[model samples]
Target: MSWDDPRPMSPHLQVYKLPITAKLSILHRGTGGALFLGLILMIAVLVSAASGPESWASMHSFLSGFFGQLIIFGFTFALYYHACNGVRHLFWDIGKGLDLENARKSGIAVLIASVVLTLLTWLIAAIV
Candidate 1:
């Protein structure tokens, strides 16, 4: 290859058909990342609280906004989905639900339960 040479990029979604298993596997990883980030944010809040009231107050004040509320809501959903799906993975590790049909069913169940739990949390949070 010369300095001025151009190369073709690898094929992406445009040339690939994403399978259900592959998509779900990738989504599991992405949601896991989101959950880890949410935990880090929680740790930051804890550190602020432990440092001093002024720090705590600043953190609390920032979270009182619409964008903060939106982030909180997204975090809650990510936490719920990751937790529910984690348990599902655990069940598979214990020699259960390894069948392809059952695996698909369990994945569907996790999605439904996560949405319900997240919605309930939001409803309660709003009421309070």
Candidate 2:
């Protein structure tokens, strides 16, 4: 359809602000990608461990660094976010929490649960 045509155009992202559910859906995809990359990094770590003592030490050294630790934290957050969001999708598949308010509440709960679970795992790991 030509822009000059009198026909009404379908609403696009540029035409309207996305709602919370849309935002969360976007985030869910992003976290899934992050988790995939994180898995690749994990494989690298394992391979380095199997390579040699020096290789394993180098990998460990990088992991112990500030930047590496930051990446690890991000990976952790992504892991938790993806898992919690997956559970949310499970409920959706069951035809529950399909309402706007329920979806919004569940999205918030997913975010909260992801953060809480990530922090709890890290804290418990550190304590042990």
Candidate 3:
């Protein structure tokens, strides 16, 4: 093909609808990135604790606020989702759940497990 000729282009994202497993794969990568950002929050908490009561108080107050709690809640879900999806990938590595039916089932299971685990964690924290 010459440079002046019309170049073939790949299809755009709107050209095709993604399947569940594909969507979950994309979510897995996204959650991984979110978890990395969450680590910065974790480090801030740690540093605040070591910096003394005033610093700790400020960090604690922020963490206790509604917006902060929402971020923490999202981080919790991302953590669980990344973990559950990692386990699913492990099974694939072991040559398990490679079939289309099993792959779809596992994808759904990962999402449900992530939500359940996150809720259970928050519930336990509240009770304790």
lDDT of 2 by residue, 1-128 (tens): 67799988779889889999999999999998998899999999999999999999999999999999888988999989988889999999999999999999999999999899889988998899
Candidate 2: residue 65 Cα off by (Å): 0.9
Candidate scoring better on TM-score of 1 and 2: 2
| Local accuracy by lDDT, each model | 0.85, 0.93, 0.95
Residue 123, candidate 3: alpha-carbon lDDT: 100
Quote each prediction's TM-score. Answer: 0.77, 0.88, 0.89
Tens-place lDDT digits, model 1, residues 1-128: 66676886668999988765566678788888887888888999999999999999998988888887878888888888888988988998999998888888888898889899999998998899
Where does candidate 1 clash, by residue pair?
none
Q: Runs in model 1 with CA error above 4 Å?
A: 1-12
Model 3 misplaced regions, further than 4 Å = 1-10
Best by lDDT: 3
From the highest TM-score down, the ranking of the candidates is 3, 2, 1
Q: Candidate 1 vs candidate 3: which has greater TM-score?
A: 3
Candidate 3, which ten residues in sequence have the lowest lDDT sum? 1-10
Error of 1 at 70 (Å): 1.8
Candidate with more favorable, higher lDDT: 1 or 2: 2
Residue 90, candidate 1: how far off, in angstroms? 1.8
